[model samples]
Target: MLDGTLDGRAWRLNDRYRHHAASEVLRRAVGDPDLGRVALVSSFGAESVVLLHMVSVVAPGLPVLFIDTQMLFAETLDYQRAVTARLGLTDVRVIRAGADRIAARDPDGSLHRVDPDACCDLRKTVPLEQALAGFDAWITGRKRFQGGQRATLDFFEPEPPTRLRVNPLAHWRPQDVQDYMIENNLPRHPLIAKGYPSIGCAPCTSAVAPGEDPRAGRWRGRDKTECGIHFIGGRMSRRKVTA
Candidate 1:
């Protein structure tokens, strides 16, 4: 029963939920009858457990989408599996790039070296777009303190022509996330202790040093900040960029 212009509904929803607690925001989004089917698009990276844990408490059976990208660190894959089990999250769906697409577009797997953007499109963007086709809305873990393009994020945003994005942790500070994890006794991503404050695909992801922006390690030596998955009107938006 979700009806109305994308912007209209998105703005209205934002106004309604902007001041709600993170847990309440999530509960409303997942339980909204008008939202149709909503899925959580998670990378299972650093701090991802916060939202995953919240969803488990609100609705453990809710569909959780994880994009593998075929180039993730072994630790990330392991963390994904462990988080799901520890949180009792059901319906954890793994989305990946098709073999045919990989063979045709990146047979040698050097596309990441030549054109990281296209590589991201094939690996993350396209796969996520396909997986999200049937859902009216999706949840993300983006936060405002991540800096760059994420500094202005809101709890709800209209996804252009159609669809809506819900960011329950949009206003959470870095300490807030850490405290939530500690308070809930959530398991941390294995890479965090290894100086990898921000984690992504293996080749494009590097470890950051102390006193560095958490995202400084990702796409290092390149100007790219995002993987092209979070986008608006053909331009990429923000993903995880916090420490």
Candidate 2:
């Protein structure tokens, strides 16, 4: 279980590594006793390969928790497998919502149509929360360039009651992501060529038009911006940690 000290530790880590490069942040984090047990939470989406590749290089055997909502695109599932094999990631854990929970909450799979937030909680957030219970911190692929609540993301953040969140690529830009993938010869998500810059569950995600936000396709025509995995209540838990 986590205590109040976790927040202080996160703040200190942020201050220590604020000016470090993304690779340095990750290298120090992988085995640093301060972080305890750390895991990488990946969506294996459009830009996931960059961080995934980084992890492969830095710590190939690190625990990688992947939430398979059971509603993802076929291409996403295939890409997950291909990427794992190509990167030689030995400890990729596939997380999913319990069958009983799905039966109780979304029997007909229409929950996304009527209540996307609840659906996201059932499929993504809850499963990830449960999976992350054993770790002191988890790493994410979120970048400040994504805008919205993530625009002010830091390298390390306190995740409320317990746990710390790490965003090694918090300062990376869209071009940085693209350039990294191209320079490293990483495999791109197949759906990207089809106008799906940002991929999520098939039912809620659509294709973005030119000059539109990359995430515009997600929950199109709906007021939902996030899947409830990152936010607490329509906002990130970004309370400043003071000395």
Candidate 3:
């Protein structure tokens, strides 16, 4: 359902602000009329504080959508509270699936054990899609350094059917994230110290050893990399609609 208009706008935004600093990209995104109602979608995971802090400085009142899968670690929940307070983010909306939906789809909470993708869809994708219905665009913390389909990520992307996805940190390196967090004295996800570089749902996440990919701990033994949120129709969408 993606039309040429959204594609062209994404390309133009990328060309205009691709080389700007992460903070600049974010600041402009908040004020850009073309972007309409923009909200930051954060997991409050490892390296998430960098963007959260940036937004706090530029637009503390901007809506922040945090999807709580209800399967996250206790530490993640606590950290979410702590960080939200520390940043003084006025509009951090906590999103989640309805209780009835969970009872019908995953009553025993064993869906992740049998089907991680289905679990993610039930707990994450569906809830987030519903929560984002009111917004024209959303900001993500994805970086090109994460690799896979994100290796060539740009500053702006069109999310089919309706929505523009903004990645202010697309060009940032790992060192940049580290330096920003350290320089800003931001608190990291508590699980990071326990060897969880990429934190997702508690059931599918594990500890990664040295020399492994930072995200290797996620869905450790599966063929899956991304949670279904970033995917379209069970496949990774790599379309780069540039001019």
Candidate 4:
């Protein structure tokens, strides 16, 4: 199904990935004599703070791309600013869907209802692709647990056309991420306690049932859980839709 995996052909990376190895992975990728510019992407979601904090530590000034789909929940937006400020992260850049494009296509921002994929292409994917094009490698916070299509995830992937992808948290368990967040005192998305375990665009996210998978609330009952932004890169890649 997936291609451009590292040494192994399968989706999983070897155990040699090391514990809490994201920092090392980042250092290697960002420091690569071959690769050029490097950047990190964030959604400022439930578990997004962990990676963002880690990025602040590894590369404080690295360009941090935040795609403001303009359809995100209020909680997510607030969390974005809070976390950026709390962590003292610099180089935070926000990407938004072009107003002209939105006015031309949706005109009312309801396009997400009729065609979710294309909505993501315009709101999330296309803009991110444009922003990421300036970099040689990008880092993401994807893990293996967010199942649907991500039962297995890799640490490094090949970005088509050019560039490479780095998954710093591919092996981290959900609890590990939670612990990291708690330990760091990072701001949590306001919607987390509202049962929207996974935050996305306001309209598509909902509350999940007890024992339900973390991502179950997103696009519930529609089989359209992914938002498309993460597909082309990492966290948003398999979980979200994108072309």
Scored against the true structure, residue 147 in model 4 reaches a CA lDDT of 66
- The parts of candidate 2 lying over 4 Å away from their true place are 1-4, 233-243
Runs of candidate 4 exceeding 4 Å displacement: 1-20, 232-243
> Global lDDT for candidate 3?
0.88
By lDDT: ranked, best first: 2, 1, 3, 4
**Where's the lowest-lDDT run of ten residues in candidate 1?**
234-243
Tens digits of per-residue lDDT for model 3 on 1-243?
A: 433588887987888887799899999988887688999999999888999999999999999999999999999899999999999999999999999999999999999999887888778877888888888899999999999888988889888766899999999989999999989999989899999999988989999999999999999899999987776445533233221
The list of candidate 3 runs beyond 4 A from truth reads 1-4, 232-243
Encode model 4's per-residue lDDT on 55-92: one tens digit a residue.
Answer: 78878898999999899888788888988998889899
| Winning model by lDDT | 2
Give the Å error, residue 4, model 4. Answer: 13
> How close is every model to the real structure, measured as TM-score?
0.94, 0.94, 0.94, 0.85
lDDT of 1 by residue, 4-84 (tens): 788878877888887799999999989785466899999999989999999999999999999999899999999999999
lDDT of each: 0.88, 0.90, 0.88, 0.75
Superposition TM-score, candidate 2 onto the true structure: 0.94
Q: How much is the lDDT of residue 79 in candidate 4?
A: 85
- How many residue-pair clashes does candidate 4 contain? 8
